[model samples]
Target: MASTVIAVLEVTLSWLFANAKGRDAKSFFTRPALANFPEQSITVTSPDCGASGSKLQVDYTQDGTGRFPALQWSAPIEVAAQVKEWLLVSEDPDAPLPTPIIHGIYTAIPASKTSVNTDDFTVVDQAKALMRGGFHYGRSRNGLPYIPPRPLMNHGPHRYFFIVVAINEELDSELLKAETTREQVAEAIEGKVLGWGMWVGVAERKWE
Candidate 1:
């Protein structure tokens, strides 16, 4: 019985040590920067994307059912003819260490739409139908579909950023057609942006 107790203790210790190490590693990762752009400059708000209702909000916990809230600006920052493409992205600056985690990337939203519904991130409909069919917001790896992965432990309140970028030219029809990496979408939209709007949301998991 003593030997069994010792074995159980060892197992428990091992698990605790591993969890500590993982948390430590996560802490080492630098979180992404909070959105500095002003609210008046843009037209949308999301709870998961900002500190308040007026900003974009990103829920840290992926309930598998909760969708990312969306806000829309009243007008396009640039004319449709000047826009080459549209891009949407979400980043958690608070993510630990090596890199900030990218929660979502969507390319090819048309310039015409004034706003996207929060449910638009996952649902297929007339609004999404207007954009390039392949590149909708909140797509996950392997075309598996997106499900937010809420951290088990809230590292304070993490900021979730949502950006809508209007680019100058259609850069990557090939990759966009093939389903490119989130990084690729970023790369394609770099520098060519005519205008961009952003929102922020805060999330922290509560321990009971």
Candidate 2:
């Protein structure tokens, strides 16, 4: 009987420790610089994400094809004539880590464009192809083209943010290279921001 009680205590303690770390994690949207930056808010939309705050379809998740969905955003208020390029970043702040997970970082989207088709990134030489077609794919947190949403089971719903930033000038060559960190991308675009916007999609994994 005493062994049974000890076993229960050990399991309880381990669960508490794991949950504490997740609760302490911070959202990327709440970062001081982004939260305080002065910019116009554009509208972002995805067919896979029916509406803001809606449940993301399984097709776009790790459980499915894990395809990067088509995305569109409103042009910056300042207009294409003044904007040099745009940056698209997707992340999940509810990840049980110190910083949110960076799903993808795509930059150099031509200022004249406001939408990307679903098949854009599936090319053989995605980076070079994207560059020729008007955008480039930067290395994601996993060093892959994209990371599909895969929240921890029983962690409740996680909010995935698709953030878009309009820039006054092209991003530096260094920032567009492989294996770029979120901090580096954020800092490089700091003073160059002309406007920004975001769309949120929620996903949850239930414990079996």
Query: What value does the lDDT take at residue 37 in candidate 1?
Result: 22
47-118 in candidate 2: lDDT tens per residue?
A: 656777788888878978786666788864555557889888888877767677889878888888887765
Q: Candidate 1 lDDT, tens digit per residue, 66-133?
A: 56565565335444457756666665655443444667666676666656655565445433322333
Per model, state how many residue pairs clash.
33, 0
User: Alpha-carbon error at 159 in model 2, in Å?
Assistant: 0.8
Q: Which stretches of candidate 1 lie over 4 Å from their true place?
A: 1-43, 47-61, 74-81, 123-144, 177-179
Give the TM-score comparing model 1 with the true structure, all chains together: 0.61
Pick by TM-score: which candidate is best?
2
Report lDDT (Cα) of residue 98, candidate 2.
69
